[model samples]
Target: MEKPVHHFSELFEQLGLASDPDSIERFIQRNAPLPETMPLAEAPCWNEGQAEFLKEAVDEDADWAEVVDHLDASMHKAQ
Candidate 1:
């Protein structure tokens, strides 16, 4: 079977963060422009559990990987 697709809100919820659209937007705005040299999992904003989850998702290429990449790109966007 194929893996279940996930949305930005779901990814945020998985990270134990606010999952609503407005909250998600605000979060991205607040944390945008993550350093190009810094990995998403290494960003200071995430707590240990959230950081571990992001790292594993990317490392394992799990079902959550796409959305996690989206979040990383969103964070790295030009402000």
Candidate 2:
């Protein structure tokens, strides 16, 4: 079986967030720099469903995990 593939914008959309490039960038800038000690799923910025989805994506190593990790890294990066 082929592994599934996903993208950054798709993950944002899955999180019920704005998925356009500029919106994605703005979202990152606004919520980013997630603390090194914080897990992405535990970020206060996400609602219950969004948080569950993020946690599942990473914990289950689903197809979404790659983009989720990318988002995590993006959020952790310095402006």
Candidate 3:
């Protein structure tokens, strides 16, 4: 079984992001918790494709869904 992702940096890699520490930290610092009302799929941090990926993951409950959910929850909690 695939190991679960446990950190933002890991999630970024899983999602094919550039997961360098500085980039990851910048991403976190900039996005943190999206506005309480914004949906994860609509968070401004995402480009069009990234947002679509997140939306489909959540909508289809794809394998990445769990990681996406984790990220969504974490971001929301950061608020």
Please, what are the lDDT tens digits per residue for candidate 1 over residues 1-79? 9999999899999999999999999998988889998999999899999999999999999999999999999999889
The candidate that achieves the highest lDDT relative to the unseen native structure: 1
| lDDT ranking of the models | 1, 2, 3
Best by TM-score: 1
What is the C-alpha local distance difference test score of each model? 0.94, 0.90, 0.78
Tell me how many clashing residue pairs each candidate has: 0, 0, 0
| Displacement of the residue 56 alpha carbon in candidate 3, Å | 0.3
lDDT of 2 by residue, 1-79 (tens): 8767888888888999999999999998989898988998998899999999999989998889899999989988877
Q: How well does model 1 score by local distance difference test?
A: 0.94
RMSD of each: 0.6, 0.8, 2.9
lDDT of 3 at 37: 90
Q: Between the candidate structures 2 and 3, which one is better when assessed by TM-score? A: 2
Query: What is the C-alpha RMSD, rounded to one decimal, of candidate 2?
Result: 0.8
